[model samples]
Target: MEIKEYFHDSCVYFLNLEHRDDVLKKMSENVQEQSLVKASFGRAILDREKEFPTGLDTDHIGVALPHTDKEHVITPFIAVGVLEHPVSFQLMGGGNVEIEVDIVFMLGVTDPSAQVEVLQQLMEMIQNEELSNKLESAQTKGEVISSLQHFTSLMS
Candidate 1:
């Protein structure tokens, strides 16, 4: 699938939240406001993160991929959050180890089978240091979207 289709300008954010829960809550609320997810999405994503962490330590920066089940998703989306300050999150493998994350990609996936493909695409994009750096330094929502679109076009 072309992952760029999942990005929306309204879903991009520059967050200054201090805590992980707060960051997820803000992104969840934004997607919910856009009608991308149900009201339960916020709580569901928070609970899921507690059970299964999504933090990744990339070669260039720390990233988090927090998502909930399809039941909470109204429509598919990938919400991007560039934190002003890094926030701590548990590692993906049920480790007690924590990593400070600078970026968050909160995914809303309605199709269960597509989750894997979407993740694979995201992984590819995340591995590109230039894209990650561009995302980190992006000054506006449009810039963020443009960067993602540019990267995803390369994948296509």
Candidate 2:
């Protein structure tokens, strides 16, 4: 309700992609067009995700947080992608755990210090199954935006 910081309307989308690369590419393109991130964002994310995964499998929903270093970002923006179907992504943990993630939160966090804060806030949302339910049930882009806005507000 408080002006919804970090949640940009242009950055939110409901995507239909069979491959994980497509999802990353879409977010990467949007970020570059919107001046949120540099052109290398897509490649960097793809490479980094291979080395250090970012998938989390919650009981309610599976999500992936794909991101790169702050140097590639021009401003802090949280891009939300609601995939039509699940796409495979490896876990950030050392083990070779693979998760089918339906939601992808591609973070273009310019500030170094805020990365942890943003992830912590997002982690809190991930910890709550109800939020995942809301996201899963959302029918429109507006509904997803509202869900994210509500989620961010509750963190304060």
> What TM-score would every model get versus the actual structure?
0.98, 0.93
* Model 1 lDDT tens row, 1-156: 468999989899999999999999999988988889989999999999999999999889999999989999988999999999899999899588899999999998888899999999998989899999999999999999999999999999
lDDT of each: 0.93, 0.83
Candidate 1 colliding pairs, count:
0
**Candidate 1 stretches greater than 4 Å from native:** none
TM-score of 1: 0.98
Error of 1 at 116 (Å): 0.2
